[model samples]
Target chain A: MTTVMVVDDHPMWREAVERDLAARGFEVVATAGDAGSAVRRALAVRPDVVVMDLQLGTGSGVDATRDVVAALPGTRVLVLSASAEQADVLEAVKAGASGYLVKSAGADELADAVTRTAAGDAVFSAGLAGLLLGEYRRLQAGPDPGAPQLTERETEVLKLVSRGLSAKAIAERLVLSHRTVENHVQNTLRKLQLHNRVELTRYAIEHGLTDPDSA
Target chain B: MAGELRQRDLLAPLWRVVVAFRLVAWVLAVAGWFRERDDYPGTAAPVAVLVAMAVWTAVVTVAYSRAAGRRTRVTLLDLGVTVLVLAATVATQPAGAFGEGAPIVTSIWVAGPALAMALARGRDGGVAGAVVVWAAVTFLRGYVGDREVFNLTLLVLTAGLLGYAATITRRAELALREAAAAQAAAQERERLGRAVHDGVLQVLAAVRRRGVDPELTRLAAEQEVALRGLLTTGPEVAVGTADLGTALRLLATPDVDVAGPAEPVELPAHTAAELTAAVREALANTAEHAAGAHAWVSLEPADDEVVVVVRDDGPGIPDGRLPAAAGEGHHGVRSSICGRLADLGGSAVLHTAPGQGTEWELTIPRGTPR
Candidate 1:
């Protein structure tokens, strides 16, 4: 089971998240009330996923995420907030959060989110994910000498993946064998020289080749 | 200080009257001395009379120059000239002329100086000036004539009393105007504050939270910025004078048909802001609960007041539902429409029953200026 942690100032909201994560079969290792305590708990537990609220009682969630991410590189942060405020979204991402979720989301979506986040699959609300990907795409489009470019097949694969297609489905649609589809994906990874699938996904996103919602 | 003196713009006519009156008074007084020179027999007496008239003319011109001039320096100059004119006239007419040893006309010139300071510098300046003149002239009156001391003292008392009274009346009028201005400012602030609270601020705060529409959020931000801009532009926001009908139509145009007189219904800034805010709140409620049905508006302008009515054809508001709506923080109707208009010396009428449509009427006295 993936280890999880939750941090929030409100007791009710904190308990609700703990209950949701527990029901999803993830082991909730700890909870915290403030940014300092969140960082300390995150370091101590080294949970695979840390679900944190943006607004804390005594400190900022962004700062807490930065500290936790620095000390425990294995841990991913999922930001939960009542606000979809643009400043909060941008600031949380800058401070190293992997995902941003608004609390208006239902319980099942939150549970699914924590599960997906622990597996290293990025998650965001529908519109907000587009905003983040758009920003990354804009930054990548800026003049850069060392930026990598994808071949026609790799670009097509990335677009399919962004459209929420699996490899089996992609093979059927591209009229290639499943094995051939896998080889193209592998070649794409090796040529792009990325270590993992997550980096490939991020690259697809940052180049505007894929819509995050498709994932 | 400059704000108080903007009334100098209004005093231009009074300045003209003072100058024209002074010129005529001086010319006639000068002509009288020349025509009656034979009556004096002694050229010295006639020359003294002319010199006295010339000094009076100079002092009156100085008073005119300062129509809104400095109080202290002008008063002192007037006193010096009056003393010189009176003393020179006494030396020439030592026995008597017009049964007077001195022109005592010098005292009459004192009125012109007092009036000049009063109208130009206002009451306090005039009062302070009139008191000094009265004191010095009372001393001069005691010695102005050898035998007419008692009579001259009485004249000094009457002259001082009259000038002082004019000073007090001017002060009272100024105080009334100041009070009116402060009231207008306070009422305008209350109107704008209610507008932001009802329409813009609450939307922004909600958008900051979840469960809010992004389109509404952007609109709220735009409106907040618009309201702030209006404040910096000052209270002269008279794009049009709004009677009850026009005001309602302005609030609900295109989507709502507003009916009323086309005649200009002049409203002070405060009244217009409050009415517009009330209309906005009512329409926002319609949009939220009325399911996008068209609203109808009407204005009724009375001699001293205006009434604005905005009605919507939709799911009618339920009976005895205002209290529940207020409890649910649907404050657009309660605070924005009803309570807001009331603060501006107006009343709001909410007409509805279940499935009968909702009609809102706001009555504001035209004279309230709020």
Candidate 2:
């Protein structure tokens, strides 16, 4: 049986989780409450998986997981907490936690997370995957060129297009001639290698240059 | 207690009004005394009138001070003193002193206080207090001096009318407060609903609807659910960043009950973000290790420090033996929760036992906002 460790402070909650895990065919190796003890237990038991609460009375699970994963080497940690803050999800991944799951998850998901963690598969919440991926892409992309090589006028024209403003409206707002605004739009499309306003909107949104509310 | 204190603050200005009334009355009475001496030189009636005015001024002052029974027993003492002064003045001056004017003046004093007290207690006792004071004033004014009982009665009736007006003001105040509180509460509910609608609930519904990802759709759905849970709720939530409690509650799921205070507690946005990430890592550990075991997560105030605690009844950790726990991992507790807290000048505490369970507490002081 795969050995798993549980860390939490509430007795009833701990029991319910343990029972669920046991039923799911995982052997419970150990449990811990605080960060120090959690580290010690995770190291000692060398459980295949560790389910940790992001919040602990005396310690935090993220720190505990770091220690556990560090010492045990192979132990995978699946973080469980009531919050779904994006930073926490991203941080847990940073801390060597294999998965980040909110407490509102069902018993099945909890059990599944342990299995997935043990399988060495990356686990994250839905919808937020885009955010994580986007962040990852940003990091990979490094500091973008000081300027996207687009002129200030180009940026303004793109913003207007994303906002659904007609060339006439953009011209009026910017106090430029209508033909001048259209020229700027054509220039922006060429610079960004975009064909139409739709593609222009997507690019602006991806770069966070456009408001989602506007889109 | 805070509500009561706030109410007291609201009533404080009323006392100032009372003080102003008394001061002016005293001044007028002294002025009237001087006028009588100038107009009716050597006349006993003028002297009587001046004395009466002086005594009435003192009585009204006493009545105002004595009205705040919700405050202390000294008010009763003041009342007794006022009544004595009124009695002395009535015996020497006009018979109308105790006959009718007394009750009306008492009513005036009671009206302000009754309304104030009612706001704190949320009961009709405030109105009752006003009525009792009004009646007492009327009775005292009616039976006192010989200034024609009918005229005294009319004075008492006029005071009652004023008292009624005061009561209306109080009622208006109460209605306004209630309306404001209700508006706030409704706005809060709407905000939370929106968060769910836009974030958590929507994610859940979407996951259910769009579970047909060509690759890892289920995981995508699950991730969306997590993201949704992370979003803040409540109307105030929209105007600014989420409070610690709201963030915790939104992140709450099957593993634990995460809750924080309702009032918005601001933390350094960057620090908050770091700590939030730490919490997420810890929560993931609970889900994987605990295997659906119950858990609790809490954020509390601890003597100039904010403490986050997560607990569960699971097997305990043996003493020492942390050598392997500190290994390098792209995803590990050290980098996830501890490192994040450490970055914020906060430390995490973990306690465990074989049969007992595990409790983790993270204490972050207010000042250390890196």
Fnat of each prediction, in sequence = 0.00, 0.09
**Lowest lDDT 10-mer window, candidate 1 chain B?**
B228-237
Q: Would you list the C-alpha lDDT of every candidate in the order shown?
A: 0.60, 0.55
Question: What tens-digit string does per-residue lDDT give for candidate 2 at B261-287?
Answer: 334445665655666667777766667
Winning model by DockQ: 2
Model 2 misplacement above 4 A: A1-3, A10-29, A45-48, A54-58, A69-74, A82-96, A102-104, A119-121, A126-215, B1-59, B66-370
For each candidate in turn, the TM-score is 0.32, 0.33
- In the range B1-370, model 1's lDDT, one tens digit per residue, is 5755655444545544545654665566556556655555466665665566666666566655553443456655655665565455555444545353334333344444444445445555455555555555555444445444554454445445545555565566666766777678878976886575455544543442332676664454344334433332122223334333233333422234443432345686567767877878787788888876766555545567676667777888877788897899877678888788889988998878887678787888767443
Across A177-199, the per-residue lDDT of candidate 2 in tens digits comes to: 98787666445323322222344
RMSD of 1: 20.1
Candidate 1 deviant stretches above 4 angstroms:
A133-215, B1-370
